[model samples]
Target: MHARIADRGRLRKVSTRLVHEHQVIAVDALTVSDMVKNHRLARAISDASWRERRGMLKNILAAGPAES
Candidate 1:
């Protein structure tokens, strides 16, 4: 009975870690999508005679610090 309880505790910890990891992965995917969308939008605007669009993108990109 004691061994079973210990196993349950370990399983719970593992499950928690797995859930957190999945959340992080989801957030990362969202960030990547946002970045790609931003780039495309910026490029489209730049192509459409908006010279300031690239500068806007640079400014926006500067806000997102590199993640470890």
Candidate 2:
């Protein structure tokens, strides 16, 4: 239950980031956000809370690429 809640919060955070960063984003739903955010949040939390921050970031950095 706690993990589910944290995942939900992470998804919301990612959706906001996407919309705020990409003005033309059309966030129809959060299913997309779930996958994307999971990868990101996992990476961020791992880095911040673990000693392998750089390794975690390098591994997950390509999870989201900037649009051209």
- Runs of candidate 2 with Cα error greater than 4 angstroms are 26-68
Which residue pairs come into collision in candidate 2? Answer: none
Model 2: per-residue lDDT, tens digit, 18-54? Answer: 5447646432323433444677576655433322322
* Deviating ranges (above 4 Å) for candidate 1: 24-68
Encode model 1's per-residue lDDT on 1-68: one tens digit a residue: 99756755555454444444553322111333344467657665434422233333334344443410
Model 2 RMSD in angstroms: 14.2
TM per candidate: 0.33, 0.37
Model 2 vs. true fold: TM: 0.37
Please tell me which predicted candidate would have the highest TM-score against the true structure: 2
- C-alpha-based local distance difference test score of model 2: 0.46
